[model samples]
Target: MIRNKYVLYFFRIIVGGVFIWAGVLKIIDPLGFAQSIANYRLFPAWMAFFLALVIPWIELICGVLLILGLFPRTSALVLSLFLFAFIVLIWISILRGLDIDCGCFGSFSRRVDYTLILVDGILFGMSTILFLSSVRKKV
Candidate 1:
């Protein structure tokens, strides 16, 4: 991971912007997001609904925090973990022969595919860099 402050800031902006956009979309239509989550068939309906309520808020907050450079490491860590989980889930859905949207960008989601994995992986990498850079600053 690159530890350069400038590069980290770039990543912060990119990743934060992505999450902010995603969160805003989901926030606009909670039921739609819930339905999207349920499409994955991984969670019970109630759980999906509840998660739709909470996940977008978390994404928005963390994205804002990352952009503002406030609690950046924690924010990056949270986003990174989310990215990892998303990657795994995407892979699982693909392997299981389920053609579904990722439910990542609310109404704008694309079909589950290798490209989704690449995008999530790239975001994961960026989040990791931002997190490690923050850690290096503290130490």
Candidate 2:
């Protein structure tokens, strides 16, 4: 748990910026993002498409709220949960030997691999720190 205000702000900026960028790219191509999600083979086509249409909007809103310092705790908690799910998905893909794009940054996403897992882990840590800071403030 990081209590340093500056550090938490830094995490907020990095996490928020990443989400906003990813969301914008997904917003540019819903079908493309849906295809990326489908490549994982974890979801049916309809569910993948639905997630594509909805998840990016959540990411964008949470990112904006995180950076704007409005409902930071809720934003950070949500992002943390989101990242956790991503980590799980990536792990499953790896275990199943599925070679697919992460669908993280839309078209810019890399293959689902250990490196990507590490990156998501770092982002998760950042969100955790941000969430902890927010909790500390409230208590």
Candidate 3:
């Protein structure tokens, strides 16, 4: 676990800021994000539409909570879960040979590739560490 508060805060801010930025971008152009999601072909169009409507708000709220240091554990866990899901989705997309944007930053998203996996993996690790350290403090 991270024993240094500064290190923990750094991770929190970096992760939280990234999510906040991504969320805002998605919120700005939900139709574009929805289109990106549909490009994946993993889910039905209706499901993609619903997810586009809801996921950005979830990201924004959790990111704000994280940066505020309120319910840090819960926020970290939620973000970590999202990262895990994203990792899985990316892997599946790669396996299916679907060349599409990740839909991570709405219109600014990058192509779904190994590099994206690496980036998301790092974020997942950071969020997991935050979750664990926060849990440790509670005990």
Candidate 4:
């Protein structure tokens, strides 16, 4: 049990770090991020612009909170939800044969594909585990 806890914490830190870095990068280049979001052609221009502003902040805050072990359950829940959304969006992009950068990590992003889906899946799994563990601990 103790070993499992340590492993969970490690996963939390890694996942948190990735999100924080990715979010901060996107925040620094909101316009670029907005362009990336628009590439999916899933939202109106204004909606994509607004999301570009807000979503990165959400990711940054939740990610930092997760790393600091503050509001772990809430943070994990938010992160998991974001990951699930990303998974769906990425899948759609793949099905549509849109070969574009995921814009997940700002300028450092890669082309969206099954591999990106796998990465998001791992992050989602980690976030889910953290959320469940935090909830269990609270109870």
Question: What TM-score, computed on C-alpha atoms, does each candidate reach?
Answer: 0.97, 0.97, 0.98, 0.96
Q: What is the lDDT of residue 83 in candidate 2?
A: 98
Writing each residue's lDDT as its tens digit, candidate 1 over 19-126 gives: 999999999999999998898898999999999999999999999999999998899999999999999999999999998888899889899999999999999999
lDDT: the better of candidates 1 and 4: 1
lDDT of 4 by residue, 1-139 (tens): 2228888899789889989999999999999999999999999999999999999999999999999999999999999999999999999999999989999989999999998999999999999999988888876
Candidate 2 achieves a global lDDT of 0.93
Judge candidate 2 at residue 10 and give its lDDT: 91
Q: How many residue pairs clash (N, CA or C atoms closer than 3 angstroms) in each of the candidate models, in the order given?
A: 0, 0, 0, 0
Each prediction's RMSD over C-alphas, in Å, is 0.8, 0.7, 0.7, 1.4
Where does candidate 4 stray beyond 4 Å?
A: 1-3
lDDT, candidates in the order shown: 0.93, 0.93, 0.94, 0.93
Instruction: Give the per-residue Cα lDDT of candidate 3 at 44.
Output: 99
Q: Tell me the deviation in Å of residue 124 in model 3.
A: 0.4
Q: What residue runs in model 2 are displaced by over 4 Å at the alpha carbon? A: none
Best by lDDT: 3
Q: Which tens-of-lDDT digit does each residue in 32-54 have in candidate 2?
A: 99999899998999999999999
Q: What does the lDDT come to for candidate 3?
A: 0.94
Candidate 3 stretches with Cα past 4 Å from truth are: none
